[model samples]
Target chain A: MKKMGKERPGQPGMDRRDFLIRLAKAGATVGVAAGVGYFLHDPFGPRASAEKPPGVLPDFIVPGVGKKIAIATGGGRIKAIDGAIEALGGMGSFIKKGDRVLMKVNCAFASPPSLCATTSPELVAEVTRLCFRAGAASVAVTDNPINDPESCFSLSGIGEAARSSGAELILPRESLFTEFTAPGSSLIRDWPVFTGAFTGVTKLIGICPVKDHHRSGASMAMKNWYGFIGGRRNIFHQNIHTFIKDLALMIKPTLVILDGTFTMVSNGPTGGSLSDLKKTETMIASTDQVAADSAGARLLGKTAKDLPFIMQAERAGVGTADFESLKPYRVSIG
Target chain B: MRRAGVLETCIGVFLLTLLAVIAGGVYWYGANPPKSASGRGPGVSGVPLGVAANLPADLAPFGREETFDPGTLSDKIDGKADLYLSTGFVELTVRRFAKKTDAKSWIELSVYQMRDSAGAFSVYSLQKRKDSKPLNLASSGGGDSAYRTADAIFFAAGPKYFEITSSAPGLMGDMKILAINLVKGQPRSGGLTIESFFPHKFLDRSTISLHMKDVFSMSGLDRVYTAVYTDRGCQVTAFISRRKSPKEAEDIAAAYGKFLLENGGVAAGEMIDAPGAKIYKVFDTYEVVMHRGAFFAGAHEVDKLESAKDVALRVYRKISEVVR
Candidate 1:
């Protein structure tokens, strides 16, 4: 909880000379307070820049966790999702009765699903349906899009899919964000987080498509957390790897779904040409984000060492980079 | 009487000051009018409102045109904003026309005005691919470099980059006619004449490309022109770039040499016949790089060292002739 700024007192019918004097006095007071606050909270000061908010813990860890990852292949997106979730011991293993599940989907671009820049709406609908069938109280689909929020959601067809599957669509608004601090980050100190959507959410799931990123090399489950951050986040591109590692440590997701049904091979993050896409027809469900991203990197013809964030996250003790050692359950469906 | 005189003088001064302020306001308004309020016509700076009139009337199309400056171009082509921004985009005019005969048959024409010819060439060159078919039109540079897809045609003339995409197939002819008209409507600002340095004897017109930045995955190597040539079942890629100075050109050529050596390329020593030219064997092909004056030229992916030397010397001689 943060205090609001003090409102300026109205000075009706005041003379111009008197008003100027009052404004000068107020300005001096604000300048002194700001200087003192800066010394106390400056990112470059002796004090630690990142601080975790109260009452928030890593919610991604499931009790009695078993297999680390599941890889499903040779099916459409919906089938692949179902098979992957089933291999991980079904949706019931994660979502219990009356649990509010938040599905953070990759709707970064307003591109149609055929472009393979966003998660498939059909997969979102199926996941929502499965969550409800598993006795979840409610399911919500949300993302802070790179393009216009409403247009990205609508064009990607995720909005309609969530509605038909009885899930609410949450779009980020300016007023809905709250300032958040990461516990141990070099870049992200105090930043805006869409806290309104996370209210009362018991379990969190990330559904993102594997695609080439112009800056980060590849975008997967770990990179999907970028949508949860607000403000002029584009500046983070200067230090993309560090920001991504910080993001991995910020949120603990119950499960992550990596959509590889159609992976964008080149000019990605926002692919404009259909030629840039390659059909891998695969999906992965995992409890370890670093392991999931490592698998996604391999799909892009890269190793975990190739992407700095993967290794960085691994060293940060967020998850494991040795995805093969996790012994991911592999299945093929017609 | 003295007090009355002072009052009159004050009133006169106030009236004069008011008059000056009004005159200044009028001048400022004229000089800084909004883009929409500017006169609409056709040219390098004209914002044509009736864009459909510029098209062939037989197409029977309804047109909607919008103009954007650097601040607002992202609202239109959000996905490709980075590409346009990198090219020094100044203004963009987009016209969407749908055929009245069949609404499904439509075309969109986008004209991007860049800062200069280099900027226009950058935007045009980045989109060029090896498979794009040549489109012959009567624009600047003869429009011979224009490439067409099944539904889109892209070309650049002067500091203007043009893209005309149609919804229906087999609109290549119509797109060409439209491009010619667009070129005819605007004043000629000149084309990238440096492209002519490549020899015409063995040049593959379809394979000619300009890379604004990062040629051969090497960053900071900007404004590079490349073309492919085939002779006796051997293919060669010729590249040329103009740098700020002779020293810069030499440094870039040396950097490329080092990059090749670090990436599995073996040094094959200098070409004795051509002074200042180095040869290397890289990935089953003979590579040669040379610097002449402010221009650095190279030939790569040739089957034989002699063929590589032949193309490299030719480009080297051409750059010397053009630059000198």
Candidate 2:
């Protein structure tokens, strides 16, 4: 209301001194903000947890006779799995009396069991029966499948096998996942692991199929542990070999079963047609996941060298790449 | 009274802008709350995926009809997601259907929608099953690239590739019905492609592969179609790629030869049938590479050099016929 740059009596219009004070206050506010921002800014977004948790998954390796391996040929899953286990000193050697066992099966897809996209229900049912036969107190069938856990479990025929075999079906829920980070590991950074399934569980067994993986070249025993991983896990496929090696380190399974009754020779991990399958007619079981996958590679018409994960896992000392060195007991089941 | 200084005025303006931004943030946060990442699981819709798929009569939906986007494609198909993503993958919808007559017998139908029909065919032909019988697709009104397996049918129509797989051996009829319905509904498409340039005689159509990038680990080789041939008990694979200019095609051809050499392939000699053709023996297999006009063509991974040269000559002749 006053003329420009003119002062009014008792109005106390903005003076140079007041302007300087206001400027100082404003400058101080911005400076403090900039200082705070400069001090707290994380240029590299979020990183792997400050400290790696000590022993994420329990080392379920049995005291002695842990690295045993067995290969069975020419049979259905029921006979093949049983023969392979028998050659590994039977379920008693791993699942003891009063032990609570967890079977991590590859029920990643909602496809039918016959498709070989998931573990065969016959194999799971037989394994559950053998676990009970070995005097296990409780056995849980669990997998954080890529699809809806319930749908994957139900459509893959694993749910009925679990329920019918008196095994608890542990479906992965939000509450079940625990953020995990492995020491000296990459790609598995503060990732959600289905840790709840391991609660009160003693022995762990991974049952997987021998199939071609478009990214990793093969989905074998070591790849089965992927089901234990949760939360936007597709990102791990970017570095699948290292991720599989990390999985090998994360889950030191008491045993791993490689189902190759019918091997997915091509278009795998999720082969959509029957022609993608070939009758390899073999099954492998081992305490050494690397060795199991090495033996299982033949089913995919490849060798350990063909799949980089096998070599990675071997280099990580998860198991021996020369599966034959284990002197795998060869069994035949009709 | 004093006029506002330039430094204070600029600071005042910035402060006002910051205040406005804060207000906008408050409004935005009030309107849209943070979502919980933990709650995200499987289905893309509010309802379960099993009931979301559209199906025809005589076949009932078996389970959720799941879908995966470019970001989530790896969730559905695992490692195979890269194959589709590299070839312009858009969306992948997977649904299973059971024969109403026999509930236990079911087939999984996965339809991968690509950016274009070429991308679709690239995926379809790339993963074409070995030893499969190429379907005339007579059941699907013809013109569709399809094949039949013991328990399934795979086809590419327009910008979508369809894979109908069944565990039951006798569900081929059910799969065919599904394929026909899907093919008819897909967008209009161009028939064949550069793939038609390959000699059909003795060529295994089902074994034809279309690699979008880094064919045989050669970065310069892209959008290549390789078809296998079985002649006189000898199995050979032939490759073809079309470029915009003849110079580009020739460069790519020579580059592939260089790539082979860098990867332990030795230059053996040249083929008399095709001028400027380079031959290489890699490990136990033979490779022949050449270009004609804007077409980059070759024969690959032949056990015998005789078969490799013969197939390369045939491919060169075929390209010449098409280029002119």
Candidate 3:
């Protein structure tokens, strides 16, 4: 009757003596774990710089140049990019002889080229050609696309652009990603970055279409740096404005080309249809990412005030949101 | 007992546990099985996403159907996944179909299964293109409505929100037919729609939308339904949100007023007709906030004071009718 009133042990291994033995086994496991931890701890040996929080990014900014922005309005992609770059002291000014350039393009989707969700293929090809012509040693095209790397590259015509131009297409893989955390960053702590593509990279150039983002107000220059992130990066979109601010701090590119040839004004970031695009017919090139996005916002019928990331980036001292403050050169194309 | 016997017993117990786990798993999965993105599932009383993914026979399947749970929803949709996740996301099933006649022609079908009818509609209305033409899907087949752009058809029926984006624009007819066929497969239910609460008088039905969270930059002020109206030469936005209690509604209304005040809004005194209603002049625009029973109502960012008051009064009376 006493046994019936009490809850019995479910198994023979859970008897009183067996329970004590299990407890002892758990204690031993803890002891072993502590011992291993103690053994691995190298107190007073190489503690200063070893296993540092950062695998630091190379300084890709074009130093010794004052902040500049150039806007080319109403022209073909080639003419606009050419005119904008010419205004900003030309491609040769940034990409020097023997300089290795990394082209960070937004191949975020594997959609049709007409959709303009990804960076234009012609833009990538043209940029690569210009970098090589500027006496660059090697110019590699890379992006950690949201879709399958091969498909995003192939269907977006970026793969063909890179292949035909002889620019190394560094497709993101698990092996290529390195965990990165920026100093004083809130969002991108211990985050995997496509760092392998940055190997021996001297100058970095950002090339992406200005599109209406459903989460962030606009996907422009700073948002393009989101491509460098890996390992389920979509989580960052929760604090999207902060994430874009972090991206601004992460990459300091030489030239950011905001392709507004046909801005995805609505249903964006992943615009499925041709109607989503509007022929804003403008190209913004800048040494400052904040200024580029600020100008790009106009194409989307938005000001810097509409996108919180613009002010956040400005507050972070990444760049100034006031494109006018930079004394921007505005040119009209035929 | 010999050491080898104890080892054998532990191994036997471990194997038994493993077998039991495997058996339990098999039974559970058999009952709630892994379904293809195109396959239909049973609906739950609460937010059942009876996903009914389909395509017309004219188009062939381009690739294998893909599915994503809440955790990996961002993988497929990227940053936009945040909006759905923050709302009431469940599962997403994606399948691409190519035109039989032309290999280059393709359409990507993204079917989002939200928590309920409200969640689905919130997503659909939130992402509705400015130039979308309304489609009568409920009359044609199932409940609720649909809209189509040049190259896409976005519609919410029951708990399922459908987005079909094609390669080219002007594929509306084909996509509409595809949407109709897809809608026919799902069970019809009048999902939780809060937009009807907004008075039809001077209300733009096309602009009627439900914002799930962070409406007007207020953190806790959520599940807000807002619509624009062309009243008195000004496009005034009328907002409404249903709270759990009358007190909660009052508190949010006050907080919204306070939020505006903190951000450079000036008190413009109370309205003449409505008691417990306040108005504010913010940056030359008029803003009004009020609450009645379990509903918080307001008008925001209106150019004209009369327009703002008119929309607010209408919304207030509309809620008063319901809660009273």
Candidate of highest TM-score: 2
lDDT ranking of the models: 3, 2, 1
Q: Model 3: clashing residue pairs?
A: B47-B115
lDDT of 2 by residue, A222-290 (tens): 888888888778878888899999889888888888889999988888886667788888998988888
Best by DockQ: 2
TM-score of each: 0.73, 0.86, 0.81
Clash number for each model = 1, 3, 1
- For candidate 2, give the docking quality class from DockQ: medium
Question: Which has the higher DockQ value, candidate number 1 or candidate number 3?
Answer: 3
Residues B281-301 of candidate 2: C-alpha lDDT, one tens digit per residue = 999999999999998888888
**Which candidate, 2 or 3, would have the higher DockQ against the true structure?**
2
In angstroms, the error of model 3 at B169 is 3.2
Q: Name model 3 segments beyond 4 Å from true.
A: A1-50, A61-66, A96-99, A135-137, A181-190, A214-216, A238-246, A302-320, B1-54, B192-195, B243-267, B292-294, B316-324
Candidate 2 scores a C-alpha RMSD against the true structure in Å of 5.1
Q: What is the lDDT of residue B237 in candidate 2?
A: 93
Q: What is the C-alpha lDDT of each candidate?
A: 0.77, 0.82, 0.82
